[model samples]
Target: MEFSLLGPVGVATGAGELVLGPAKRRSVLALLLLQPNITVTIEQFMSSLWEDEPPAHARTVVQGHVSRLRQMLAEGGAEAYGVELVTRGSSYLLRLPEELIDAHRFSGLMALARPESAPQDAVSLLREALGLWRGPALSGTVSGAQFAAAAHALEERRLAAVGALATAHGALGEHDHAAAILYAEAAANPLREGLVAALMQALYRGGRQSDAINWFHRTRQLLGEELGVDPGERLTRAYEEILRAEAVATQPPARTQPPARQQPSGPVDPRVQPAPERAQQPSIPRQQGHAPAAQGRSPGSGTTGGPGGTDSTVDTGSTGGTRGTGSTGGAPDRSTAPRFLPRPPARFLGRETQLAELTRWLTDTGSGESPIAVVTGPAGVGKTACAVQWSHRYASAFPDGQLFADLGGFGEGAEATPTAVLREFLLGLGTPPEQIPPSADAASALYRSLVARRRVLVVLDNARSSAQVRPLLPGGPGCATIVTSRSRLDGLVVTDVARPVPVQVLGTDEGVALLGTMLGHDRVAEEPDAARALVALCEGLPLALRAAAAQLTARPRWRLARLAAALGDERRRLSLLSAEDTGIAAALRNSVARLSADDARLLSQLAMGTGREVDALAMAALAGSDPERARDGLDRLAEMHLVDEAATDRYVISTLVQLFARDKEAGEGGSPPASTER
Candidate 1:
């Protein structure tokens, strides 16, 4: 049996196409096929089916769809081909090889076509890939907002493949063929500057210099009027090249048989060549004036830019450069660019899955807009560490340099205001200090204009809310931004389409490995059981694990069992997990201190409950409040990561967090009010 998601979701057997039931069932199959061999959680299915507002019985509905799909597959002889719909825990997995899915085949072909050494092979592979798209992806399937987003992403991939195919043809001296392919695609996607630039290049090379120049002017006018931004560096370079005298009169290729491939090519112009690394956008021509520095200053220096540039102190003066004009009147020297990422932790471990997701988001060619990813979790779950590590690993992708800022959302001081961050970003991007706009809106516009044409990564750490990160986001497709926050920032997900990546605690094995990395392998090996026990006591939190490992390392004579025993005591565990500057207790305390009195009281009461989980009704009985109030309090606690919603309304507080809450409760001598308790 073969699956198709390139158009309508379907299953095909030797007999013919099988009849998949209802629209929702087809949608379920489509979602599963898109992520073949991976688990699609029930929650994800519901979200994609109904979007933000799911029905109360969404679980039952999703289970029905899955059951129907399984029945259809089985009747269609999917078992003969080794297809299986397996239920794993709270998720469902559709087990199928990559070859069985058309979308996967297309992706595979595109990957094989990316190398510069294989233009002929690329042309063949890309042609096959393009032929697989029967129509708009997942067409005629049930549509929801989430499903629409996924379908849009698939369509974007198809267009990118088209662009790549044309590039491959051009490399083989088939300019007319490239021009024909790009012409139709460009008309279909007017906002795609990369496609537009490719078409312009093809037209100029095909002896239509005047027509190419006309297209450039039309594109520039459209982009400025629609997006309020000029044509990107690639398009601008193409226009400049066309203005040169020698480039005006190249003869058109013969309309007969195509010329044979030859190896006499000297140096290829980088501007005209397709950049497989950034297939969604045309490659920017290398300019002569600026070379990015190898390293930049640490964040929070009140100044950002190349070495020895002026500091980015906040200025409230009305006198500044015009909006959208990156003036350099008082700007720092442009010899060095700002590289603000902090060095990643030496002993970083785990998060392999999350790193892969981030990589895909950064390199995805389907979306025409700049990608935004939000890394969120409780304090010390390693959100920042994971982001920094990935940024450093892929730093070379953004040669223009990385920009880093600490929003101070959960730290000691006031949160870093968006205006302040924008100011620093503009300065770091070489906008003169005097030319920086005083208003945040104007500064943001200027910052977007400056980085619109460059490939850069902006890491916004500890963002308090969506509004805080919004102004800092770059406008164009050439950049990607990663924001780490304790809050989930749901508003950003809904409004700005930011991808939310929740970082969870490590598993037992991962926690143990981290301890081994921090402490000596021999030491952990000496007391393997004790090391596992310590990990359990620390609850697999990176900060707690690091703290425990630091204490043992500082006192080499202390046995791992002794440290484990110390952590076993609930009353003293928080203190035991504090070593040097790393303190899990301090972090929890800070989070609690920011909460309202009612929320704090609710959290403490819930922490004292007998079982690991509690529903809103039980919480209300315990807290002597109505169910509505109890539910609201629980949601607030969950948002702050003090309590996690294990399943629906059932909430689970981690052992370590419970201990902190209990400590506070004991200190306050708090208990349920006599009238409120059952």
Candidate 2:
């Protein structure tokens, strides 16, 4: 359970209730939880907790309470739920997901149970919202006027929920139950005209017209005495309709617009736009005659269903969704096809074997297994580029079009959530944003249904784990999914029978060809030996080669030998292989950022190994742990492609990764890395 502002203020866990120390402390936490994820200043805490007579050192007192609260939350491992208390200058923010707060969750349920929603769903949603309240709102935690007012507001909302619940019940033709629900709430809030109206309507619908008239009269008198006002429009309408013995509508008729065929997420939909870079990014290639992409596109849009090209209007987080040339036009309306494949990163290098294997796997899926290609390799080895290049190469094979999502699996940013990705995928595939359900599993079902027999290519790039990719995988054997990640994604292979396609760095000749293409052939032809040195220095990594080639292209006067010599210095080597702030160092930093602190420290330590190939015993000595622990860490690191097992017990720390680890060691003021490979 999360914070329970509807009844008492509390922070709870799976175990039991947490003792929230003092009343003032509970008050502080209650106020923060009431408005989670927003800045709450010390002054607001003081005002809410003490009102006019706060202590002289109120700020210090509030700060102490927050400090202790932070420690308490940390001890509970609240970070697992993405909950944390952040400090912003003079204010404090209690950040947590919406579902973690009872108030927010209740409010979300209430919003979900719209008058137009299905009666059963609305009833269930309303009852769940009502059940969140245990007792009087903030009963034990209200220290001052502010908390009392907050409690009053919540109680008022509860009355509205009760009325809505009654309306939902009536929609299901359970008029007796509706009258019962409204009676209790109406009695409690006699002056609430909406509840009074609902009670009247429910009573009449249950065939108690006289009882309905009597209740309305009682409420009318109470309202007059309380505020000297006549009954509101809702109350008057219900009363007039009942006197005529007419059946009155308790709420709007249930929506018949096919669910999942339109926006149903109501509010707070997690639909993702393409990654932020697409704003100014050059449009990726479309089929030869396809309409040009709308400028802002936004990649998260565009899902091609299958053979019929079941398409949807794409929303690229901008004014217009990308429109393909081959749109359906008619007298009623005209809609264009949606495209989601990203542009080729650069001129693709040699990956014919990898491409052939991908084609072969999909072809072999004739055995009835849906092919999910788990493309794993070291960072900067061109896994995404290879997949994209192949996708572009075989566009004709899947006329339904391609769907692409950058999972943001490995980077400084938060991982792209499955629900968020599913929303985007559904939006791309043909589902409207409103039809995209709030539930990850539900949206995923919609995805499977939409793509059941479609030959769409679902490419999930930069995935972090198998769990992240599982829900996004296409269900039909007619469709295929290509998942690229630094991790091997072994879980997918075991459970989903996914084929593992490993992409390594380019060959020396392949690297030269790619670099020569980026630079001019004349330049490489002029200094063939230096061109070879440039590729060799980069270990044939396409990303590194691209970065180097891009730089030389920028400075045409700079000789390949000069750039090659600069890269030879181990100190500047990683830094030299960068274009536009994205280099080997940055990629390594992102990869290390995802590892455990111990694993990261072990990585730097491993770089200090005695030789390129080291056994578990040697790693144990380097990591200062026993053999078993060292071996386990090595296995994990190898899974992430940071190290490779060269033999039964020996591992090879590639020269590039080694340099990155050593650089990290020095930057952090650790013992200098071994003069050479450890």
Candidate 3:
């Protein structure tokens, strides 16, 4: 069986090419086959299929396509070649030999066709590699940005192969063949500096120095007009080498470029929150308890924001699940002062200390500056619930309107830009839509001007970065802003003096009590030991405990031990979390998804280890890089809440997060960075 992404995405088995049906079905297959034996989440499919907002039921559509593809692959006897597509949790995995993928095969051939290889052998490998392309990859098939980026990355490698091939031809003393190859490729892609450099060298080697020089001048003129720059180093280096009449080597001389960012395909990883080791820490808190939502002023009808704020369009949905008595996304009515504090959490857990701290700091009145409080934690860690719960408790202090914006920093959806958020806040403050300025700076200035003396409460939830929350900070005395985010938003702390309250998973006792509250006291009484076991399984995360409770409540026949037993295995824990709709797995994915390609790769490597705590040395061993890189990666992972710093150099992975990481590693198909690293 062969899966091809080199040209049109296709599957060819011993039965011959199988019909992939629609373009999207092929796209689904193409994306899955992009990394064979790896799981592609439905969210990733939606991301690859549509660049903008996907239609409702996009998940169902993707499932239908996957179902049909499965039937076709089964009927085509793909299993005969050890290939099969299967679903795991919220993701799909395709198991097959990597050699069966044309893209993978192409890469392998390129690696072997190095410029350092013997010219004859290199030529053979290059021709075979180049021959695999029937046309441009994913030809005639439209896809979203991720696919486009992947295709662009693939095309780059193909060109690199072409350059290596041309150099081989030159080594074989077939300058005309080399020049011909470079000429045709360069003609089509006149802007690629590498291709131009190779073409120039090929012409020079063929005793056509004047021809090469002329080509350089032409390219130089084209670059100046089109790109507003002269030739880059590669083109210039080849030109100078030709001018000096010096002999050149098989490979072109140019500065090595950095690798491109790797595109991670899955649910975004959760934002990481730091915590002391369980024993070292005295307490940790989770959020619960839904308070009455403070109402917004009457909304003005038919108001929409300016173009610059489109992505930041405000949804008037109460963050606390309370419905505001108004239409969504309208200007606030000036008749009554609005109370905008989001309703507090519905299921309040522990976090008394943090709440009191917020109350003391922000309510001081004599602090001289508006107090900004940030509640930081990983996704599913209940940061938002804690922040809002506290906000509702102190609602009487800020009689002015309360403002809330869910800056989608850590989730599958687009991260909210500051400009978009400002528009919504401005409108919420009763500024007419037409009066709203188009630029972020202008809008921010107007908003600050209008809010100068108001004692408003601003709750910015799910913020991606500190920069996103800065402009939304209102000015005035008696005003306070509370932000909930995965990152610590250190910049806000440093520059804006935002107070940070880090939310960790609930402590053991609080987690068990919360679980009992969800499942009922009788259930806990009946399975006393089992209840404790379940809490340990949940690892003090309220979201996980709530999910486990909900799962048990829905199926009363299932004992707590049964659920506990199910979650005992690390590998299946995340899958179980998904099954229970616990949100931990998705949160983990969201956090992981935020990492840079290199950092994500390092995470997968680190997850391949055996022990729970891995210091920089162990991480370095797994990273197969320097200690500095491993330390940096560990710190980065910890900041994202993917890993936790247990000590100065030691990092720890939660049971659920570790499972998700292993799943990602398995999907990408690699062994642990090293078996001995841990």
Root-mean-square deviation of candidate 3:
27.0
**How close is each model in CA RMSD to the real structure?**
27.0, 25.1, 27.0
lDDT of each: 0.72, 0.71, 0.69
Error of 3 at 646 (Å): 1.6
lDDT by residue for model 1 (1-678), tens = 788888877888888998887888888888898888999999998888885689899899999989988888888888878899999999999997779999889889988896257789998888888777765788767778767888888898988888887888888888876876787567557778888788988876875544465456556656756898877888777766754432223222223332222221232222222211111212221111111111211223232221123331222111112221243122222233456676555688889999999998886757878999999899879999999899989988877657887776675435666677776676566544555677878777767766766778899988877887888899768689999988888899999888888899998999999999988788899999998999889888999998888667534567899989988888779887864333787788767766777888888888888877999999999999999999998998888788899888899999988888888778768843222210
lDDT accuracy of residue 531 in candidate 2: 89
By the lDDT metric, which is better: model 1 or model 2?
Answer: 1
Best by lDDT: 1
lDDT for predicted candidate 1 compared with the true structure: 0.72
Q: Give the TM-score of candidate 3.
A: 0.52
Candidate 1 wrong stretches, greater than 4 Å: 1-335, 668-678
* lDDT (Cα) of model 3: 0.69
